[model samples]
Target: MIARRKVLLGGAGLLALGTGSCAGRRMWLDREPKLPLGIDAQGRALWSNWSGLEHAYPASRAAPASEAELAMLLPKAQAPIRPVGAGHSFTALVPTQGTLLSLDRLEGVVSHQVITATVRAGTKLSALGPALAAAGQEMVCLPDINKQTLAGALSTGTHGTGKGITAIHGTVTALRLVLPDGSIAECSRDERPELFHAARVGLGSFGVLSEVTLQNRPLSRVKKVVRLVDTDWVLGQWPALASQHRNAEFLVLPFTGKSALITHDVTDEPVRPRGPDTDSQTLMDLKRLRDLFEFTPGLRRRAAQMAMKNLPEEVAVDEGWKLLSNERPDRFKEMEYHLPIEHQVEVLREVIARIERDAHGVFFPIEARIIAPDDAWLSPFYQRESGSVAVHAWYKEDHQWMFKLIEPLFREAGGRPHWGKLHSLCASDLAALYPMFKEANAVRRSVDPAGRMVNPFVAKIFG
Candidate 1:
């Protein structure tokens, strides 16, 4: 404990002794790379992910208006046909030189039966929420960001924070996929059980999901509350806190020694919609603190504590769909891992200590959320309930430190990387982490024997 305090104090003291000029600080903090041209040398239009960290110039780009159109194009398109959703992923999964397939035209709810809705895979969650509401249904859980397509979110095993709530893939009852050979297949627990489990979290390597049937619940309102709390206290009480709320998560402010605890619970209260977002403003404030006080660690800590302490809690009540998902205009590259429930806090503590002692430029808060277990073959939360830790770097920054420092800690704690996020694990490493990795790979190979769906990144993962 004394050593940890010394590290924190040492960081602040260095900031004080090595104070740099304001102009120099501004230049350093705001520096960013110049964006490339809209079109490449061959005149192929440029394509980039949400964070602008990954891009590719595909030889051909196709937007299939219907499943029939996709089926006809998949077998003939180039070797390594890749599907592009909203391009929200930070990894190289979407980058391919062969073919970029867009499902923009094939969207919306295809059909509905009581509590279940069969929606086209291309439908965006932002649009699907209202469509489901119109049909008197809503997804049981949704990821914090609603920009992802239903298929993309499921493929990546995206999730929201909540007790007893699994990732979106858990809600999938059936799926229709177009194999690399231009053949279509449908899978459910009752039919093609192996394929059902394997392809549910396929990471876009098994096949392209064309349609999905989700088990939804009746639309309802929820109350959301966000409050600042002492980081140490919250960390100690997290397990109990999580169990007490319907949905719960927290964001730990790196230098301030505090965290924002956010929770959502079922409520029938009158609509008291949330106000304009202040998250971006708060993030910038933290960055400014880093920039201005890099040389004065003590002053930085005092200033942050003074500014954040006693702030009023944010409260809102509205339909669960609207309040649960957020519109994240700011872009950042991320690395997240889901670990065994018991080790989450220990790993988080070590990571925070490492950052305070070493990574001085990091301003983004570390996000902590819990997830119930699921049966998806590649799911990080396979058989045991999980606690996920996600660290992010601003889009303009380099995340090499994440791979060098933090990833090793997570790996040591029996963590599994989020498929669409940054990680250094390969096929052999992943096989050791997941018990069903071999089975999933076998299913993928049977469907895509010619390797039409395998890009260089996917090859490294599935080799």
Candidate 2:
């Protein structure tokens, strides 16, 4: 229920008292974590993900400027040739000891034809928006974070929220991949269809995507609305809300008995550009509340409820591309799963109850969204409409509770883990979740017979 302005004003007083003698120990326990070595003993530089949970010191790094250069380097580079984007993923997908392949130099809009644009795999979603807008086109869907490269987004099945909108890979009509053997392969529904299906959500195991053709739509304006509401009411009305809006999602504030409902719809209204970000400060405010009242659930709920009451709704009119994705500056570890749409509400109820009952140290909001199904063999949403639930922990806090308390619920409900997020499932578990898992792994093996792209994590996933 806490709005940006109100929380800023109220937090100033609470924060001052929070640092006093009574809460001094809590502040010390929440300080920044000790950093890893900047450079290892073997002279390899440290490469870490955004959350700082995953890192590696590869023996070599390559930034090839052109497809020709990338293809030429692939066959002979060090083993476990891993491609890295912006390092936004929390999982171990990007960490490798042999070679860190960067496609940063091979980025831009390659070509356009009305509603379609061929983009370089290294093009970040942030840059791709304006580039596509210049041609009067935009992607059909975009993930919540725009820092990831096109290849990274597609490979990991990144998605946005909507009733019928699929993940980013669903819009990919065709793609060019540079195989481990240095051979270039072009695939689509009509050409090499098997490879197309297997590699769309490839997790960077089959090969590195060089270029992708996206099925897009005309650039248009949209209205975005954010309102605070009772968590139970929102949960009951979610199906209707999702169907009514162009896009819809919600954030659950644990111990607060409230949630933020966000929706977007196509609009023709005059532009009222979005305001500066207040989400980061609001998150920190929640953390402050947790630190002060962690031992008293009743007091925590009352404080948050009192602060959030009767706040004004926030609205903005802008291009869909600008409004959909967000800038997340604070770092955290996350675990997310996509489950059958019918099971979402029930599972979410359990998640919230479990967290509120046991995880008093939790302060980050739980996120929920809906995604349409796609045919990509490895995609979590394959052949079934899915509603996703994500739980987070501040980077410096312990995340073992997610695996111990939440993962079992997801597994029991037949949920599939997000490829880029945290989960404990292995190849056998995955094989049961995805109907095409065996075939996808076979295609991966055929393309990279020597396992040149396989890291320890990838091996565990494909075994």
Candidate 3:
């Protein structure tokens, strides 16, 4: 029996099929169920991924593991079949009406070579990090948040603030994708290359991403240094930093006149070190308090400026994974765009001007990053060397105005929006941005002809 009744938060008792302690059960007798057919697991006003500002309550959610298990459940996939990982996305890309695919059971190292591993689709990045470091390796790069699932992060091309490297997908040499028909495939640069391109950043339109074969290198120690710099001077020095550092970027505090410059690089070969994060709570609290202040309207910006001006200088060194990831306690709405790498400073100048002139009501820091182009069809940096700029606001604030102010600025500069980050582009805009947009859709059609893997957003963008 896969069904068991448990008391929910309120007086209500909800029955979660296929996920109780007895998930180990085989076939159960078909029988009428008392609980409503459509509901989420744990049922706490759930949304897909952590792009907290975008979605609220999904119609339903599902957590499945194993190829045969996911195949058995395809017939019941949600209308949008949006797969979610740790809710890390900033967009409604995983918005769903029927089912939400959770890959929690499909976790841990499935198979491994000395350097590489074949990972399950539903694995969380936090789970992946410690495991690899124990084996004397670490993920090449990671976004600020590490809670996202591997499949979901790569699906939307989540990135870090690296200089020459693309996002996590850049290191993927192979993929094990599940077609809508439940057939599993393993694709790589040398074999089934076309499928590899299409699936690398598939946006969950092709099928469930069952597993990924990643290209990993030997893990080595790294040094992370964070310094305070004037925004003007940082921009002035962009050229030199761009050339010298493997990972270099700056975090700008709006109207604060200060920025946090960060650089991470490899050191002479040594095992990475780990220790307590003395500043962990302080950092988390700082982010959380900023979001709290953002709700008070006119007071938020003033407070943000004061807070930034008073911040003390900080610098640290730690394991590559430990220092690269942050414990994100604040939740906000966000939109990020990839523009030409050379225009990074100029675009930022214009954006800053708009914020100052139009009284743009955003308090979160503006993040600038660089990415070398890749062959992934849906990749934001496809065929273009690019610099990405991300903007955010507290979730409680009115975001439509924020989106309106930034969308045109991005378009005028030939910007491409991050698939997982917030943006307001339709199919036509995306079609113009990538030549392979059509080809990617073609591959999806071939793999999921009936559109079983699609949701409304996926349909609207690619149909």
Candidate 4:
């Protein structure tokens, strides 16, 4: 199960990926009158692009510089407005026909109370990490990629690979949001408690998030020990591996049963020699080399297995944000589901068998990780032990065949799909899995009754 990681290494900032999904995204680039008097030009008001899919609204793109600007914009905003950060999520959470706001210039670290950071919604995770490190602090957890905005990550419960910790949203102690009625409010456990719980992982369905206060930790380097392990060994030792590392993830290749595990931990030893982040080009070259000879999937799989043999033993470095994240250059459609922690390995094994047997025409490493439950109302890991299984296929692959073949297995395992990734689950599907769905909806109703925060995707899941 040797997993290829080009998809995981692409770093933050979706707009820069130039995958061309947001081609109409240029509409908001023009100044007012052309923008404000009526629905604007070249770009749709709001849209979402991940891998390669787009859903946009004609009048939904709006960019507000301050809370006051956002307040003014919301009242005038069309009914289906939504705020966007870096557009990194593969989900349709941001697309709308009403108004899509970008807070690109609304970034900066506002206040630092020791380990706590109050940052504007527009701040990028990449920028936040270095700033926090300067203050001797760092985010406790983040996704394998750091390109998302602070507010966006929290909104969708974006997570990192860790045993007991939930996603990065779990770090939020407080938040400031603009309601649908153009009113602003601050939420926290001690503040507006109900709003705090729902809005923490609200999936941009409450209102425009203005700013956030993150609970951080002192900056420290992690020791990443990379090793090659057969799939059977990893499966048997997964429980122990989960206990051994603070943050752990494993990738299993499609054709081969061989697997490789990447483990990261804070270490006392100084950094060691590390390689560049771009390995996809090299792998692509290797694949092209063998494919010219008309190699079989089994042969291609063996070639990948051989590549890992001489791989670097460990990457020990003092990378602040860089070390904690990945650069996903390869474009791929992804669907991730979270089930009870006990069910993770079993679901994975079955998924592998199905893919291997059906030859579903999907290629990429199936990612597996563990995340403990959190109190966030809409978080998939809420109220139970959780395990996240990510099913990804290369962009050019036939998704219809692959996704069709995979969906049934996930359903049988009682898996909860990540809100910002891909999923077929609707409100009924989500409602049953998360008993608090109605309660979370209630919290959302109190804040944004106008549904200004919704788009087609959000409406399907939350309405």
After superposition on all C-alphas, the RMSD of every candidate to the true structure, in Å, is 4.6, 1.6, 12.5, 8.0
Computed on alpha carbons, the lDDT of every model, listed in order, comes to 0.86, 0.91, 0.70, 0.72
After superposition, candidate 4 runs with Cα above 4 Å error: 1-48, 282-312
**TM-score, cand. 1:** 0.94
The candidate, 1 or 4, that scores higher on lDDT is 1
Candidates 1 and 3, the one with greater TM-score: 1
Cα deviation of 30, candidate 3, in Å: 49
Q: How do all models score by TM-score?
A: 0.94, 0.97, 0.82, 0.86
Residue by residue across 1-463, what tens digits does model 4's lDDT show? 2223342223213212332423234323222221232224655433446455545655646677788988888888777777788877777887666667788877988999878999998898888888888888887577777788888888877888787777887888899998888889889999998988888888888887898988888788877766667898899899899889988888776665566687878777887745566546633533332232122456445554554454444464665465767677766677888878888899889889887767534456788888878888888878876888887755545466446777777778888888778778888888888878899998888777767677778888975
Evaluated with lDDT, which candidate comes out highest? 2
Clashing pairs in 2: 1-308
Worst 10 residues of 3 by lDDT: 1-10
Cα-lDDT of candidate 2:
0.91
Worst 10 residues of 1 by lDDT: 1-10
| Stretches of candidate 1 exceeding 4 Å from the true structure | 1-20
Weakest 10 consecutive residues of candidate 4 by summed lDDT: 30-39
Q: Candidate 4 at residue 314, lDDT? A: 47
User: Candidate 4 at 25: error in angstroms?
Assistant: 35
